[model samples]
Target: MLAPVLRKIIQNKTVMIERYLPSKGNLFVQKGDILEPFQKLGDCMHSPNTVYFPKEFEPVKFLREKVYFQKGSLIGKIGAKKVTADENGYMSFDEVSGEYFYEDMPVKFTLLSGLWGEVSDVIPESSVLIKTVVAEVDLVACTPNFSFGELVVFPNPTEILEKFYLESFVKSTEGKIVYVGHYADLDTIKKARDLKISAIVAGSADPVGFSFAKSANIGLGVVSGFGKLETPDFVYKLFNSVAYRHVFFHGDLGVLRIPMSGVEEETVSSKKKKTPLKVIKKVTKGQKVQVLQKPHFGKIGTIDRVSVSSIFVRFDNELGPVEIDLPNFFIIE
Candidate 1:
């Protein structure tokens, strides 16, 4: 029983995005191929590449810092006998590609080249890409003090960001998310001064609604498309922010931007959940007891439960659990 319940909870939920430090941004260069003549760098800052972010980029995760970038794809490995750039206002990179070292590296490029160039693109104003994991544990084989490996669910990632704060899970918890679901008012934004949740998931921030998970320093994601708003596009934007490299899709469906570790699933054996308490002693195996003003002139009823001093019983015609006071209490059957 517990196996199925736990499986359902884990299966139905998708983190979609995880938070990271604010992107320092990334390095990018124009001139097409790496060997393009350095003079062709007519303000390489004008060119932009498609950057894919991780699935957890929004909603679940935040950028802790602003992003930084380099001019060329080569990361600091240019060889010894190379010509360095000192006048183009570009920086030098000692980067090794394939086999040889390339020296000159550009300094900065437009952070939003693709965003600005593709007039038709409906880039997300904000979003996040998250990674997910399915953890398995043998309920029967483990005790309260036992290890479930990596089964501990992550905290409400939104709580870790500066713009967003965490809330209590039990106060009016909708489910497992501790600090989500209901949110405080934007006027209370100052109240978030001490919160630890990440940025808000964009667009969903309606302080007036029941589902409004208020966003603060934490990230909040929203939907955006070429001309409309769509959930998938909103998610994709997060991936681009992840991969300033614009290289491979982390996922098969042209979805990359995330570097995931320990993403594999595990198998485990489990057992059913038993009732908290069982019948300890009974006067008869099947004969349930009843208290009456007179032994034979009473009504028949069903035993709902028992306590130290009384038994809460129910009858076929009754509306609710009825208490029967008794000097001593125990299961009759």
Candidate 2:
């Protein structure tokens, strides 16, 4: 029998990434220049003009529909306390809803290299292209988004620990890519969005939570298919080793990329050429595989025997040898 091959990780793969600004901005790196993860790449002034409606804001009666105010100017009162403009902005009252909103001015956004690499190309006033070697982890499913941030790996959470594990890292999670646990529920996804987490990596996710992530524009990558599943042992160990490193999550490509160190890159460059990666392979006895169905979902086992349409797998757990349909398992490469 033939089966699909799931490559959990590819080490020392060369890749190019483009770091750009939303608008035209200054470029701080040139071709062939070495870049560090914390180095500033460029900056741009852009107006997000975010609208805000303060809770309990009660506008003064007979106030103009729209008014401009300096910082600290009184807008209204919240209960017995006065509510003032937080910044120089325009406040407009919504006649239909009886609410008010403030819009602020342009702000500066600085771009960081976010990786250890060399500048391969530059797009003047816009972006810099970098060439780097990295270790890549495959994701079975992910939202359509792109994010780069410091990777934070947490221990796999038990049912009880999952509820409170994220709370412990509340202060440090903002703008970071976090590995929550083996399974993420809807509440976990909602909490991550509220905490401003850049992305979430999990072994499996609740289908509803996955849908919410897409709608909320949050990055979510799953190593295993949906529903409660354990993270593959190899993937967990790899993440633990790279914790705190700058990483890239390409949800559209279904991969998490961790840049390799300069020494590691040089070592890979000196090694003999490797053969092409195989995506399909013939099923045989003693092959490692992962079950994709219930009863043994996400479990890794060794094939004991292969038939025309089924394979008997030997798991370390007491389940002993079990026969799994060919389509219910995939070779783990």
Candidate 3:
């Protein structure tokens, strides 16, 4: 009985943390060092520098020739226009496609510890594994990527992330993981990226905008299912409770992790004391659930009865109980 309940606990005792070195170099900390979210972990030298210019240029020679260009020197010609080197850099050409790209001089790169954890193991100069306690919120949908930053909250989830709201918080959003309210569209997402926001959390988003987040490589996590849904009150409260804390958004794993702080320990303890309820559990009377259908999509309600193939739900929106089929409701686990 407890095994099924334990499965509902999305967060566990330990997290596997990975930090990448741009190139192999010195590992700053050895195994067993306690790490903070922003501590320097390692450093590397001679990281690749890639420059992509407009597609109008036509190269005179292929990159297989391994040519070098001086600063402010002409490298290619686009009809009457000459393409000159912006800086002293090596040039490599893709002979197969007849395309060339300029590579700037490599520079030193520093790697930072992304979360509060203990170094469980070290892979020499390459990477390290860290283990720590965390609280995770499962995202309904998300883009695949990893990001970490201080969590910033917006006051209202009903208001769409419009231009003015973002403009008001431009300074606060820079390099931070911002929680944009319900239903962010493409324009808002583009504006946030322009501001260099590290990541975005929202209740729901349009499919086109969500796809753009994926293509742009912006970290995004959707709390509720997509399309115009206001974030549920419970989820909003959870975010507010952890505002200003550092969070890790692991989109590929569908979890937004809030590493346990002293204040968070009490909250975690209280949750553990409560009986765990799972979304995949067999429907039982009086179980609270979120409805996922027309006229009640994203609304929370209570289970009234369970049949062979359908369960009756008493929604906050409806006057009487309504019948819904299996998999159409998610328990508020």
Local accuracy of candidate 3 as per-residue lDDT tens digits, 18-63: 7778678888898899988789988878626666544566766644
Number of clashing pairs per prediction, in order = 81, 0, 1
lDDT score for candidate 3 against the true structure: 0.75
Candidate 1, residues 1-333: lDDT per residue as tens digits?
000011101111222322211223432332222211121111222212223222222211122332233443222222333222222222212233212222232344322221101112121322223233322111111001110001111122333442233343213212111112112234323332334222222212332321232222222222111111112222233333332221111111212112222321222112211223233444222224433423221333456766665666665567986676653223221
TM-score of each: 0.19, 0.79, 0.72
Question: Which pairs of residues have clashing backbones in candidate 2?
Answer: none
Put down candidate 2 lDDT per residue, 60-127, tens digits, no spaces: 65464667778888877878998777788778877766667776655898999888889999999999
Supply candidate 1's per-residue lDDT for 14: 27
Q: Report lDDT (CA) for all predictions.
A: 0.26, 0.84, 0.75
Candidate 2: worst 10 consecutive residues by lDDT?
266-275
Candidate 3 ranges beyond 4 A from true positions: 1-9, 46-49, 52-99, 104-108, 157-161, 169-176, 196-198, 244-246, 269-277, 280-288, 293-296, 301-329
In angstroms, give how far residue 254 of model 3 lies from its true place. Answer: 1.7
The deviation in Å at residue 46 for candidate 1 is: 12
As for TM-score, the candidate ahead, 1 or 3, is 3
Order the candidates by TM-score, highest first — what do you get? 2, 3, 1
Q: Report the lDDT of model 2 for residue 180.
A: 87
Candidate 2 whole-model C-alpha lDDT, 0 to 1: 0.84
Worst 10 residues of 3 by lDDT: 1-10
